[model samples]
Target: MKHPSQNSSPSLDNVYRIYWLLVALFVGRMGDLYVLLSRRASTLRTYAGDTSLPGGKRDPQDHNIELTARREAFEEIGLPLDPQKVPLLCILEPFLAGNSLIVTPVVVLILDNTLRPILNTPEVTSLFSHPLISFLHSEPPFATEPEMLEMKYHTYDDVSSSTRPGKVRLHRFMTGRETGGTKPIFGLTAAILIRVATIGYARAPDFEVNAPGQPSQEQRIARALKHDPIFREAAALEGIDPGRIPEPSALRRQVRTRDKRRARSKL
Candidate 1:
């Protein structure tokens, strides 16, 4: 069988750096596929009580991004670091977070859905999961949680860039606190899942995924490296040449072809 990592973009191999962080989308099949997630500890210093994936910044001792993701998962939720049990699916391209941290997503499939989670109280308060495909569709999965009087299930907000001219689309999906859910999954977390679902399912979202005029993912990253001193300094420290950033057109086409082939093969 072909490995999941084989489908990831080639450009990911060269972008590791200090400011780079990772989030593990621990996908599992429970009749339907679902993703494991945790709510940040309310007492933490930053982003307290926010919904997030199992991950953190890359440590100097961590040799690779995968290890960083596993280590963070183990620390925050007591998820074991055995690759045989939690094998990688793919590493999605990097995303520039609002905090200026470059976040990379590491998608892993949880082979054992029955494995119990041990939560680290200092970093994570509670753990819950949502249907993986629900990200692609705006409607809530269950009928138990009815919509709030005036609240929308999906919301799109345009965040204007301070360092550049274009705006980035911010997507928020209401989780509806069905049973074991926390707040709405929005911002970086929501955006990451949308991309992951698209890649995993080999289809476009039912709704428009990006803002009408937003730049492509690669273009945004390239612009950040060119115009933001913070990103430039990090790239310099990592010995990455800003001039070598790949254009979005080539990479986008490559991904589209790969997705088409996978669809044909029923992979």
Candidate 2:
């Protein structure tokens, strides 16, 4: 399944270069499908006061992203993830964060739901989780369509002038049963979850299909992004021309037709 936003990410050439050293892991409880998440410490500067999956920068001791994710999960939450029990589901499409770090999301499914997260204070302030069904249900928890929120950055030597008044689509994976201030997920996290819901949980994805007749999944995703400012802005950030931001309608149709052709071929 295609992720929420991979096509039109911004160019981070001028931004600070941290390399591919960071990773996040979606740790799912096998039976209930609840994914673990941590609330970033208020003391931190970057992505401060945001909720995110468990992960950290890749250490020199780590060989790959999988190791990095496992290590980070343990360090951040003290969740001892047995490599044999908590199996890696997939490596999501890598993306560049606003901070200029290229991040890789490692999806892992754990055997039990009895998770007692010990937050590594200062890095993580708290812990919480919502079921995958909440996102999949599409009625109460998360909207049928992703929500867009305006973004603004204090222009530093690294930031471009165009990024001002930046607007991005926020993925609100609210727990229908819980009430409080909304904890919205954005950018790479949103993109990864959208794909995870559809692929890992066997749930219908969240997107809008513009075609009149029955439209394929590809067409739906393309149409959804066409209306998503985040997608356009991200692509533009990548230094792609404005003309290349929103994908053309004809190309969406072409992709839909080709998908059908491949299906028929297999049949």
Best candidate (score: TM-score): 1
lDDT of 1 by residue, 133-184 (tens): 8888866675544446466777888888777667888999877673454678
Which runs of model 2 end up more than 4 angstroms from their true locations? 1-31, 113-115, 141-168, 175-182, 209-265
TM-score of 2: 0.58
Candidate 1 regions exceeding 4 Å error are 1-30, 144-149, 178-181, 239-267
lDDT of candidates 1 onward, in order: 0.73, 0.54
Q: The CA-based lDDT of model 1 is what?
A: 0.73
Residue 241 of candidate 2: its Cα lDDT? 56
Per-model tally of clashing residue pairs = 0, 9
Task: Give the lowest summed-lDDT range of ten residues in model 1.
Answer: 9-18
Per-residue alpha-carbon lDDT of candidate 2 for residues 196-240, written as tens digits (9 for 90 to 100): 676766757544211224333343334433444555454456554
